[model samples]
Target chain A: MKSKGALQRAIAENAAGYFFLAPWLLGFLALTLYPMIMSLYYSLTQYDMLTEPVWIGMGNYIKMFTGDATYLKSLQVTFAYVFLAVPLKLGFALVVAGIMNQKLKLIGLYRTVYYIPTLLGGSVAIAMLWKRIFSSDGIVNAILRAVFHVNPPAWIASPKYALYTLVILTVWQFGSSMIIFLAGLKQVPDEYYEAASVDGAGKVRQFFSITVPCLTPVILFNLVMQLISAFQAFTQAFIISGGKGGPLDSTMFYTLYLYTKGFYYFEMGYASAMAWVLLAIIAVFTAVIFKTSDSWVTYGSGD
Target chain B: MSTLAKRRLYAALSHAIIIAFGVVMLYPILWLIISSLKPGTVIFSNPGLIPESVSLEHYVKGWAGVGRIHFSVFFINTFIVCAAVVAANIVSCSMAAYAFARLQFAMKALWFGVMMLSIMLPTHVTTIPRYVMFHSLGWVDSYLPLTIPKLLATDAFFVFLLVQFMRGIPKDLDESATLDGCGRVSIFFRVILPLSGPALVTTALFSFLWTWDDFFNQLLYLNTPAKYTIALGLRMFMDASGNSSWGPMLAMSVLSMTPCFLLFFSLQKYFVQGIATTGLKG
Candidate 1:
């Protein structure tokens, strides 16, 4: 009887907790978990929205590897983009952040100016701006004609240069990563720098030893986040390429292609398979980073 | 040079470099604004910052929009969606965060872990099934698919952010509220909610901006020009005009970026603090 009473009390105590968590729990099941299961099931079949899913046991996955060349090209383009864009962006961000972190006048104003582009980078407007500015007769070409006396190709329209324009767009919006790095830099104690200087260390040496070691955690975090986002890059490529991934498919981002297949072609099953592959790629990359993080990432005492 | 002189020189050099980069960084936006004000005929010919002749013709044309649907409709639609999303995220995320931070639920650890993992899970993995589910429910092309999921706290980023903030609040406040014969709900209303103002503001601001900037879901769900958000409206304008309407497009582009600029300038403090805390802690 006492045990039964205790059980009742426990239930009453925990009831409010469950009540508070109800919305999120329900959402997780409906929007996230259930959808994930259904997506997986769809991946193994052939289906369009108009008809019932016909079982096809790994056909879409097999086709991705063996049958389609555009799929292969998209994979290449996306991987190239991720590798190039992530490093250039992070490097540029770190450099700017180091400058921004300095004790200088009007630093806040400079930070704001630098950050404005990142605020609008994801918009269709900026992508449109990028597309025009890199066109054959646009501002960039006009400037090249006057200054260098040499003709420049229409960067966005050229297959060789199209992907780089996208890369440049990604790198231009390095402000968010820079802001995060600046925050991390501020948390590093001045004492460490002072002590290093007192021990006859130069600025470069102090930076390499004290600052780099301290910032490895933030660097790791930024790397993983940037990597994931870069893989999923869509808006710029989509808008700039006129939603077709044209110029000989040089800028066919993985997400854009997935969007094309799922929405435009209405190949639901194939899109589902592509989505699963994307998930696996992201998971593997993340896991690899986490596994390797022990060598480079150093947690502070509070952490 | 003397030590003081050397320090001053270094500071000046740093300032110069920052200013130079700042100019390069802001050049495209400046060009866009300047190009928008130029007369439609000479916008491409005079690709310089200084306009040969100024006019508001493009702004007028852009605001008139393509067909009979004005830019005002898109603006209203976007604002409605943003407002709904912000309110929903704040309410739903805060409640779940309060539970995780203070309440002693069974399976709390498991739930918290799942929430964190969900933060990393890409939306693409589930986009297809969710799209199908919403389609079957007859929510497509309406604001329901866009707004309803927010009510259930589908955005786990805000949930985790609020959880982190709530955890930092003094547990003694809850203890005292209980002492005053306050129940869990009353305690939440009277103490926790009021004290979590900054984090709540952070959540609201991001929710507002992200919803405004959202394109993928809006593109998928909103097909008709009548129901279009700003992003979709811009896309429609692009498709309708193609390369022939550069001046109007630039004008509309500048207008589309105005809200984010206003929010960033007005709430710089919260923006920086929110980013710092979230990035550093994560």
Candidate 2:
């Protein structure tokens, strides 16, 4: 009887566990899984939200590759933004982390001060703040005028400089990456540095040989994540361009273009195609990174 | 050179570098605060770090209405949505996490791997089809689309974090609890939930911040301005006027960021641990 009771209890426990996870499982099916499949189907069709989707295999893909000029432009702009922003942001973060890791007085205050921008970085408020600062008559231009006595260009209004404003905004939020780098720096053994000092290694040489090598995995992690995020950036570009992808479409990022196609034009099929193509691009890049990571990434066991 | 003198020089140089970057980092925010205090024309005419005099008129104007749009209603709606999301994430994620961590289940590893894949799939890829699905279900312009997802373990990052923490807990506790004649539910409620406080807090805080800052999803799901969250509401503030009002807009922007700032300070310890572990491991 006891054995039977135990068996029944085990079944009951499994049932309860399933019940607890039901909501998430249901959501995955209805929301995520179904939508993912439907998007694949939509990519082959011509959908305009209002009318039923019309099947047109390979046409949307062809247009994106060949016929669409904005798609190519957005791709190039997004690539430039990703490559420029990710490396520069990570470099700044590493420097800040190194400086803060020193045994300085009021270290906590410095961390807090550095992290403040990250908390506000993605907000509409910051975007508005960016708009004002980069505007023709804003403080930055005012400083330029006072210092050089020359007219400053409208940062956001001018197509040539709009994306750079975004790059600056991204670099300003290096606090998140900086905090991560600080954590990694804490994990480095002090004895290694002590030994390096005995070997008469300068600070720069110690950093290059010991510090950089130890921090490579963390750096790789930061790089991959930042690259993915930069490619998918939408909010900054959207707000700066006034949600129009404007100023000669210079700020038309990949995701913004996808949004415009999907929502603004209601070309759901074409948008779905664009999304899939983007997924393919990101997947290839991510796979390449993962493949190369094995060559350099040192795990805890150094395997 | 004396060692003390060299130390002083280095300290001064470091401080100078930090202070210079600090100004660059903080000047825009300081300017936003001052700009919000200024009147519309003064914001453009006198763009400096500090305002000559502060005025509450912009706050009043932003709070009340920009023409016909009421910012207060949007604020209330955002609060409701965020609160609901926080509550759901805490309850559902903890429960699901307990199972994934302690309970012996078939194909558990496989299921966990699948959950990880969801994290890599850019959410934008799924937005349109999800919109269509919600529209077909008549959930558009409703809170259901936003709130209901949190009840599921759809947030793989939170689930992964919880599972990692759970693994660190000793399994002997589970066996001992079972010897005490406590059933699985009792063990989970009594043994697991109490010990999992920090992990639970971390998950809850992230949910609050992410949902609060979410714009794309909010913009896609919500139709009417009255249903907008703070993120969407702030965007609407920018788009409301044909001509932008920097002063009032910046003021409203500052107000919108307050909750997140307050939450971060109140829960700084958990926030730091959470970001360091999850973000750095990416």
Candidate 3:
């Protein structure tokens, strides 16, 4: 069919391509794919790293649902966080983005100020600061005492308020989502606003009718991303709660619990099961969003 | 009032609201800096925005560090790991990206799809098995676990990002280079890598920042006090001091944030562009 020279050339190109891809291929096989399959297998077995894995089919999953109160607590906490934090963060992001989208002279400076917390939000330093600021005698309480002359509870120490503090911390780092919203806002054409204005639309009415519809796709994206990340939030909880998920297990994020099971408790099988469940949860949430998106998400007319 | 006067009033109102929000947003960070400078005994007692007096005592004591391991060591260790990750991600990811972007290879579409999927797949799924594999190899309690996987292009985000950037480069240049007797590898090095500067910088910046901020892997892999990275060291400092030494802890926290602040301020454009493109496209 083809000339020998052309065939040789094709072979060389294939070889080169594979050569370049070798690193990722090796990593995928060794690191991702192999580990994934092994994790799934491990979830069905009870193996501490010290001994042989004893297979008991679906035992770990059953134990998680029925036997483990901590597991249920973690699930409850993570779901609550995902539901609470994601909406609050996205709402703040959208509102801040709307404000920043105005033709203000100091917008850049404001954006930088808003985004700095997010830029450093994941680090241990910020987490440490969060712990201090929410403590009984910390700056937050001090400010409350000074201004409002009221005795505020130790937000991070109290079992009731600890998780809420983490939620507040999550909301504080909404700047990345805000930045994304700003970019999406820039893509929204000005002609729509002009046309709406010509039709005697008030600001509030235009925002709900035109702006919200146009930004639905961005909203969906932020919501899903934030939901996934919020479900796995660990560092803040780890540092704030001293890696115990305590003040009565109120702030035990799913990933934090999984980490403890894997590393601290050495219940590798249990942790693996948790990981798989997390995957399923994320998958279901993403699927639900995508399925529901047809009701609300609108691509530009050009699409 | 004239329409122009009304416009001025609206602008003033907008500025006031934005500034108020900005102050609230930045108050904590400002407090950290001010607390770091305040006398150790008065940090919690004096919650005023303005410090009554300033001292650099915390900086001096914190830099001396706990248990004879200087804070400088943690900084150096973090920098080393971050540099290795940045270098590794740039080389391995760009090579893979080049293959995906330019080369017509077998099962390229399948591999690219797998790569994209990996980007969304959480690290927790792979972490346990990777730890086991690393442990079996006796690579646990070392930088190998953190840095070696990076060399294998395990971070699919960088590869995907580079692929997106490289696809925008016109293909005629690659063809021209091929005509000029440049081999594929040579073409990659000379033509593609050079032109993909912004993407490479983006990769490097993100790789460095992520590696620097990474607590989990560093916490898992580095066991010794001598090998502690900044994140681990900061945790250790908090544990060691408890609530007794707020001044030094605040000082070290400020120091820990300095490099990130510097990078963000200097290369803010790239950071903004990186976030926008990745979020919008994904």
Candidate No. with top DockQ: 3
Model 2's CAPRI class is medium
Which portions of model 1 show Cα errors greater than 4 Å? A1-9, A300-303, B280-282
- All candidates' TM-scores? 0.97, 0.95, 0.97
Question: lDDT score, residue A57, model 2?
Answer: 96
Q: What's the DockQ for every one of the candidates?
A: 0.64, 0.57, 0.66
Q: Of the pair 1 and 2, which is ahead by DockQ?
A: 1
Kindly list the per-residue Cα lDDT of model 3 for residues B1-282, writing each as its tens digit: 996997799889889998888888888888888888887655764567798888899999899988789999999999998999999999899999999999988999999999988877878998898898999999988888989998889999889888989999998999999899999999999999999999898889889888888888987888998899999988888878666667777799999999999999998887788777776211
Candidate 2 chain A: 10-residue stretch with minimal lDDT: A294-303
lDDT of 2 by residue, B1-282 (tens): 996897688888878888887887887787777777776655653547666777887888788756467888878988899899889888877777787888766566777777778777787778899889888889999998998878876777887788778778888888999999987888888888888889889988888887877777787889987677778777777777744455567778888888988988888888778888878221
Stretches off by above 4 angstroms in model 3 are B280-282
Deviation in Å, model 2, residue A215 alpha carbon: 1.0
Off by over 4 Å in 2: A1-13, A300-303, B2-5, B45-47, B242-244, B280-282
lDDT of 3 by residue, A1-303 (tens): 569889999999999999999999999999999999999999999989999888999999999999999999999999988899889998988888887887879789888888898888889998988888889988899889999999999999998999998998889898889899998888888888889988988767887887778899999988887777777788899999989999999999999999999999899999999999999999999999999999999987722
